[model samples]
Target chain A: MVALATQTISSMSNTDIEIVVDDPTAPEENSPAVASTRVVDIVVSLLLLALAVTLGWDNWRTGASWDSTGPQPGYFPFYLSVILGGASLYGLGAAFVSRREATETFVTRAQLRRVLAVFVPTLLFCLATQYLGLYVASFLLIAGFMRLVGKIALWKSVLTAFVFTAVMFVTFDIVFDVIMPKGPLEAALGR
Target chain B: MEAFGLLLHGFAVLLTGKTLLLMMVGLVLGIFVGVLPGLGGPNGVAILLPLTFTMDPTSAIVMLSCIYWGALFGGAITSILFNIPGEAWSVATTFDGYPMAQQGRAAEALTAAFTSSFIGSLVAVLLITFLAPMISTFALKFGPPEFFAVYLLTFCSFVGLGREAKHKTVISMSLGLLLAGVGMDTVSGQLRMTFGSAELLRGINFLVAVIGLFGISEILLTMEERLALRGHAAGISLRVVLSVWKDLPKYWVTLLRSSVIGCWLGITPGGAIAASFMGYNLAKRFSKDQESFGKGRIEGVFAPETAAHASGTSALLPMLALGIPGSGTAAILLGGLMVWGLNPGPLLFVEHKDFVWGLIASMYLGNVVGLVLVLTTVPIFASILRVPFAAVAPMIVVSCAIGAYAIQNAMFDIWLMLGFGVVGYVFKKIGIPLAPFTLALVLGNRAEDAFRLSMIGSGGDMKVFWSNGLVGTITTLAILLLFWPVIDKALTSVTRMVRPAKA
Candidate 1:
């Protein structure tokens, strides 16, 4: 069993309590998928603060001042970085003190699963494109999604994905004449 | 007389056979996008923009702008028939428009909504026609200081006037600016923030960022919500339209008031969302029959729809004249403008008269075409709302990926897009505002350039922003807007003490 992290907090308007949870998505029972808003706010602000520091330090190294020709490259950006750092610190402070600190789920578990359901396949599709090319990659992606997420039959998924990919091939390849990435299979056919 | 002649020539340029077909196609496409869930005005436009890359700027802008008009019309259809707002501005439309539909007044509601949209957009177009030249003319005289003042004003106004927390706005804008600095600094030619990656040298493409932020993130957000719509069925006929037309004259005051509010908000960075709410509340507050508002008052529908369309149309004015986009969709349009190698601003009026005038002409024609098209296709679109979101999500994802890849035809951008999609999702989850980020991403370099130019011109003295009266007043106004919350709190507290028994 996956260890679940659960918290409850008031909403943006303090009207109702929302459950914030982090649990693996299980089709069998309810999956606590949403990350806590407080967690997200603090983490994002920290990342922003980190970015501000990096940018500011970089500016300092590259002459963040005025010259005879004009201001140096980092002149304006240095100030912007300082502002970013300040704001990020403020955001960090406010996130802890926020009204819905514990309960506000940035994204629910089911939502996370759904997003991952799309995101993971897209990543795979991008990887597949390098080897198999756009048409094959897209067909596999669409079919995989339909079967996995849509819960459609394999044949239906393949057929629908095939048709969609075919239309795209014609529209982009034959008519628009835009070049698409191709693989050995596409090269097996005549140009 | 000069403006009249230019408009006539604009119509002449716009009425070409190819442009007419393009407008119709764009309208159909826009309505389809609007009817679909998980894709919004800004998202749809940004996703569709790259496909028009090969077209002339005039034709491209005309088609894109028409799509914008059609989306405005389509938003009301979803609101009235499905009780779902297709765009943020359409949220207010559901208050009465949905109620009217529930009362079996769906056709009447939709007709009134579409017609009011037409009127509102027409009014905005007229305003643009008369006012754009003057505004552009004024802007033509702007130097680096004045330009920087305006840019600062825009940034500060968003931070001040926007409902988001000030810290979040600052963080979002700063992040955007930092992201913008990742490319080759055109002025110094010194590459910073490339992280030793060759792809990073080109900077993040606005089109790619927008597609990921709006399109991919929208999918993620919707997958969480899984919106289900049970649409109201209504007769799509001329009789219903005529009945609505007959009812429309009575709410003329509402229409006018909402249009004015919309035009005002749209020209500013307040956007259509704010305009619609303001229009609805003001109409409610001032109406003789305020009691009937949420209970299916036709004026309720009239107020929001008119304001939404008016603001949607007028938002383009600032983009055209000052090169500052006032809304998300307009920001996407500004990105499109930049991609097309057409520099938007005061010089556009002088340099690209045909493009400017033709776009204006299309606004008039597009609204008319959009109104008629949406009015007749109500039942078709209403039925489309029933299509399960599961079937649509994959296609959107695919489209977004294709758009991202197509921008540079590089795998790296796709990776960047995926990264930004996650970033977008995280931002949404954290309640960090995306508008300031988007605007800052698009305009960050320009603002920086103007600031540096001002500094150079004035030997690094920040006083250059306040050198001229125009720049000084604008800069002061920007400062006030940025601190408006604090000032407003202070004044209101004093007022509370002065009139303790008022509440």
Candidate 2:
């Protein structure tokens, strides 16, 4: 039993080690990594603050007053806006205070590059669904993501993307009977 | 006799072909996810929750809970085999488990850990079966104030017991509460945080946030460093498993003790991690060969595994009896209960006896199935490590995208998932605990609802939480937990100062 337990634990550990090794943290802080992380934090915090302010302004302009009802529709949300705004401000403060001392940042350029590569394509895919319809846009989106982010060979990327899109289309549309958005492009293609 | 009859009815439901099939399926999928590093039990359940929408509620929950058990069992496999823990709870196992593997006694350690996990889960299940109804009956007297106090207690205990900095945990929890304030106020259909976008009206789905935090973030983190997939050369044999039975008797006492510790910790909010840590410490102190613990002692592997499994299973008890989830996974199960149109409160057992009993019965069946499935597949799961990271990374990402998209079939969820991925990455960078964030998100809405309802009932007076006897007791507990850290820190500092003076 002891040997069996040892073997089981060892096998599991080996797999975990391989996974952990991929992004093993350095025992000592690296200056470049630290600077990169701090910059990302500052930028993201600012973006969030801008979003909160814009949303708060929009809600204020709308005829929907927060006090219309016993508690207005915006009553709870107004508080959230303030809280989010506060959190972003705090994040900004931390970033600024830490910036003076050339401390290590968490976000590296490489990390940002990787994040944007996938994030941008995904955003575009969502937008495309509005114009190109679900199937056509999905195919294009997947193909684009594969080619750009995955760096697969053109043919392989196209084939894989197309196959996945087709399967999803069939599964959701045919099997599940859920209607998907079809854009002018899809209509023209007779899809 | 009445309880026995109900259990029989439960057995009848569990014995059905559908329930049995789902139990097996859940176990297999759970083991697969659990064996993978970066995918812990909660993540595994969240990733697979979408698949259950098409099934009956009882069957779906059975499968999900079974998957949870399987994941727990599967976690130790990697920890022992390669010194890698698939989950944080399994970290202790790697200390001694991997060393035992290095000594070529891998099969012995695997069997013992697996058996101990089984024993722990089974013990907890039995306790739940007998104790749940009694607790629910006692809880039936609670009103909104009591419920709110319970939530406060939960929050306080989690903060008090948390390993992370208290300030960070509070911040994360407050963020969750702030997010919960986004959707429409339940009492008065007024929109709270929509700003102007129609999409914001629904607020952020807990499932989406979870997928983003645990799944997408995991993918991004993996991309930072190039992971190598190395396979183990040795295979576990049945003969080896059986031969270790003789030594098992020596560890039986430790297993029982750890199981008790696991149960106690699991019952308390934020106790799972503490329970495992306590079990490990106790085991080390009690062992004769304590010096060999971190090096390769079998007791090291045995203690934590037993405690983790026990705590994980016991968390379900409070969820069933009190309508309060003890962990993120239980919170999801609570969502499942709501989707099934069954409210999980004191009335759950009385009003939906069949559902409650059937679920209990399924736990019994599912645990056995999980143990058998995980033990047999140890070698097969270990081989997955041989797959190249280049291939595995993309697959994981695709699965994450699919899981996110499946939640509400809304394009916005995918975007939300990406945003969460970014948050997850930042949290990782800052060394913030993701567990608290996830837990806060799961419990935040319920806490807000209880708080608002309690205040409304009391005419907006905060004193309501302390007015009733039951509520007062709970409030006192919450207050104590809230200030525990200050007391502990002061004591620790005083001790430090006094030690030198005494010397």
On lDDT, the candidate that comes out on top is 1
Instruction: Name model 2 segments beyond 4 Å from true.
Output: A1-31, A34-191, B231-234, B491-503
iRMS per model, in Å, is: 10.1, 8.5
What TM-score, over all chains together, does every model reach?
A: 0.93, 0.84
Which stretches of candidate 1 lie above 4 Å from their native place? Answer: A1-34, A153-156, B496-503
Q: Report the CAPRI category for model 1.
A: incorrect
Instruction: Estimate, for each residue in A1-191, the C-alpha lDDT of model 2 and write its tens digit.
Output: 00011233454434322222222322222324635556765776687678667656544543234232233334444454565577678777776676542365565565555556555665566567666666676677666665655554678667876787778667665665545667786577776
Q: Is the docking of candidate 2 incorrect, acceptable, medium or high quality?
A: incorrect
Instruction: Residues A14-123, candidate 1: write the lDDT tens digits.
Output: 32222222223323235664568888889888998998998888887776887789888887778889999999999999998888766765665666766787788878
Error of 2 at B445 (Å): 3.4
**Interface DockQ per candidate:** 0.22, 0.18
For model 2 the local lDDT of residue A35 reads 54
Error of 1 at B99 (Å): 1.6
Leading candidate by TM-score = 1
In model 2, the Cα lDDT at residue A31 comes to 26
Q: Candidate 2: fnat, from 0 to 1?
A: 0.14
> Poorest 10 consecutive residues of model 1 chain B by lDDT?
B226-235
